[model samples]
Target: MKKRLTWAAAIAAAALSGCALAPGPSLDSKRMHDDLGAPTDTTVYDVKLITPQLIYALKQADEADAATKQASLSTQALPAESADYRVGPDDVLGIYVYDHPELTRGASGNAGNDMSPLVDIGTLQASGGLGGVLPQQISALGTNGQGEVDTSGQRVAANGTIFFPTLGRVHVDGMSTQQIAALLTRRLGSQIKNPQVDVRVMQFRSQRIQVTGDVKNPGQLSLTGSALRVVDAINRAGGGNPDADLQRVLVTRGNRVMTIDVNNILNRGDLRQNIALQSGDIVHVPDHTQNRVFVFGEVPKPQTVFMNQGRLSLADALAAAGSIDTMNANPRQVLVIRHPNPPLAQLDGTQGTVQEGLKKVSYAPEYNKPEVLRLDMTQVDSMMLATQFDMKPLDVVYVGTAPVSRFNRVLTEIMPTAQSMFMLWSIARNR
Candidate 1:
């Protein structure tokens, strides 16, 4: 009878497994949306300069050292006025004399020491020959054909060399105003009594630097007496936009090109990369390229998202992508397609742990002791469960349906006992 009962139980179990429950609405099985609108091979990965591991290492390395690094980065020499000055062609000069009135040129006329009307030496003639100095009539008081002083100034051919009465031809080109004035004073000391001279730039016409790229207003800015820095040029060009890549600023002077990290210099005070600009230098700020990731399919709001740090993980990326749509999301079947190489190593390691655990279980005693099974999904949760593991720049994640095989087995086991009980109740009622 026991044998017959066991046979009956085994046959009932088999029959129940094959029996199809009336396919009413299948509430037991999870409904998965296969029409998840075309499978997209698109993903967004953040580009990070410093890896999380590296950041952790840095944090671990500097418990107290962080303060020192911060101080060092913040401590920069106050930006002093730059003294490196260059005299370019066409820059105007104003020569003056302190006590010696006969040696200076004021705004009005060449009073006692002042020279005649302002000389507009039309752009300097660097190309030398004979008539290199383009002659223009200068109205100055001088002895006419007869060696006599004329009170009324008359237009005369002022030789390129403004004969400062005694001083000879003094080439102004390439020489600074101070150098020219000192030379003139030394020469006049031989003829005039105490000669005091001063030199100043009255106007700046030629000195210009080109400013270009990603600026509101870009053009040539003239450098006057005050020195110009990288920031000054940027300011002149109406500054950069909020999204400008200040770190990639470029300064090209003639044949040489210098890259300046303006962001670092401004924020961290790293002056090592802050370069001095020169005349004719081109300051360029190229447009920043869009670095972003497109997130779609099973997300709350499927759209493209940008990252400043340039890198994101599967879990973190999902969060940024507005996370899985809880209504349609199957969290267990989250599929992350990554590069087939590097991720394999990580997968192997994880699989190794899993395999070792399985092997240990296979050899474990039949005694059922309460064993703690810790599934660490929170830490390193970015890693996917399958073979091709490490995610690349762009990867597609497909969240699938829940595993229904085990649930089906549970139903199969319970249905037979319930059916037998119902049949027995019907027979008892008939009796």
Candidate 2:
């Protein structure tokens, strides 16, 4: 009876020890319970049943949306294209006469005295004594120091009012080159038979656009004519650096400011957001400090991923971090923590449902819908499925221990005792 009781006690102790030796739930599971309370299986599918913190984040995102709408409304009152652009003080103009050579003399007269019928009329490159002539002629005009040249080799006064031998002081400010040329032709018609005048920009010194931040090179870029688009300016700056946040490009012209998504143009091929640039405009490329997502847990290489273009999905993010640990990974518990903003919130909220709906709606795995994702790394066949899971920034992919790992640990602990007991029982039976 005593032997029976001892054996029973031994068995109970062994069973109790075995239970203790078994692996507990993962650290992430424990943390989830502690930080977010117990996660119910039902709540996993329903966003409404999520934690209050998540709901608060969602509300904050909604508030941001409202603010964005209000700001957009304010800009709606402003003209789509600015009309305040006037020929400002000290602004340079490029003058060209096309086929008419005599009317296209340089204001500085540095083109040499050969008096050729046709001039290349290149941009003004004043050197040595030639630079003084143009500025001096411009100062003589009664108007501001802005200068002009007429067909008769006459330099206009500072006020852009040049008195030709026939036509006296005509105001050329606030007028297009074509308009000014036509006016000159009309003025000179009576003096000279069938006079022709031509004008083109020579220098773009006054028409400047400031490009600052996150570019390979950042500084003031020249805008010659109306051809200097936003992309042209960025290209002039040597394009965005590796870490540039192409999503938010700010353009401020006077009191008006516009935010353009350059990434949309590059990535999605959306040309609508490509806006035309204007003079005295500031193109600020802010540092891409915010659009980063951290990948942790059981990924092979955990890191903070920089998002260059539009929204980054979950699977893309995971692949970027060298993929999850397939050897000891659990795909079902992949956690994606996104911004509380509406677009991201909406994306994350619909993820599970979309994935599930795909499997239900589409018979083929490849035809699966967007957002519904499952991670099963058990077989090599599931590799494609793993690849299909989209990843968002700041997403956490945890690959827990394989079942074999847990079983090995438990079996190793029990094997020594089991072997010793078998040996002792054999010795007693032999005796």
Which candidate ranks first by lDDT, i.e. highest? 2
lDDT of each: 0.49, 0.54
Candidate 2, residues 1-431, lDDT tens digits: the string is 56655665575567668855678773545445454566654523321212334435745764575456435634552346643333433444334333333344443332221122222223323331232224333323222223444323433346765444345567766666677778778876776676646554444344578899899889987654455667778988999887787776777777656667687677767565566677778888877676776777667888878764646545567778887777655654455543322222233222332211002121332222222223444445455544433334334444455577668879999998798667655544454
Clashes of 2: 21
**Model 1, residue 263: what's the lDDT?**
72
Cα error, candidate 1, residue 349 (Å): 33
In Å, residue 142's CA in model 2 sits off its true spot by: 22
TM-score, per-candidate, Cα-based:
0.45, 0.51
Candidate 1 lDDT over residue span 1-431, tens digit each: 56555656666666577656655665533476466579885544432222355345634654344344334323432234446333445544445544343444431223221123342333222322111222221122122335332333211122223334445445555455667677878877877677666655444544678888888888888765566778878987899876565755777766545556577667877665554555677888865453344556667767655434333445555666677666555555455433322111222222221111002112221121211111112335333422112223344454443346446668899997788867655544454
